[model samples]
Target: DQQVKQNSPSLSVQEGRISILNCDYTNSMFDYFLWYKKYPAEGPTFLISISSIKDKNEDGRFTVFLNKSAKHLSLHIVPSQPGDSAVYFCAAQFGGNFGNEKLTFGTGTRLTIIP
Candidate 1:
């Protein structure tokens, strides 16, 4: 079964602190991984991504680390801000068909950054 899992339903952090979100996948065929951030009433925006061949990827204040051996991945946000409060989804694309590589999303984790 293809299942991307986000264990924590929510996370709370004070502004300017670091925020870490974890995800797991059981499917070995997933070669592309992505993290998306969403605000209320808006679609998710791509944050960071990593291929199965790579172990880490970073963008500005966001970093994503993939541990293939452990079937796990994580997103780290540095100096978290109050504006960063939103839902985060971990998604993966599997199979050779890029067009058919449907995004399997986690249940989503709500991040709250306290001012």
Candidate 2:
């Protein structure tokens, strides 16, 4: 069962606060992980990614941590802004399997930033 799961359907945070989103997966073969942010009626934009080899990866305001042993991952956004409000998708790719590198996405989490 190659399934990526986001338990929470939504989250809300005040501006300038921290926002945390969680994800889980059941597939053992997944090697590459990615987080994507999507705005209303728009395609998802890549935020951050971590390979199974690494435990964490960080960008300017975004960070992603992977726990391979637990088959879990999370995304953190600091100083959350109103502009940061959108849907977040957790995706995983199976590296070794050809054509299996396609991203398997979670149901998605909608994050809202309150001004």
Write down the lDDT of every candidate, Cα atoms only.
0.94, 0.93
Give each model a TM-score.
0.94, 0.95
Best by lDDT: 1
lDDT of 2 by residue, 1-115 (tens): 6399999999999999999999999987889999999998999998899999999899999999999889999999998999999999999998985778678999999999999
Where does candidate 2 clash, by residue pair? none
lDDT of 1 by residue, 1-115 (tens): 5389999999999999999999999988898999999999999998889999999999999999999999999999998999899999999998577585789999899999999
Model 1 reaches what TM-score against the true structure? 0.94
Off by over 4 Å in 2: none
Q: Candidate 1 lDDT (Cα, whole model)?
A: 0.94
Q: What is the lDDT of residue 94 in candidate 2?
A: 88
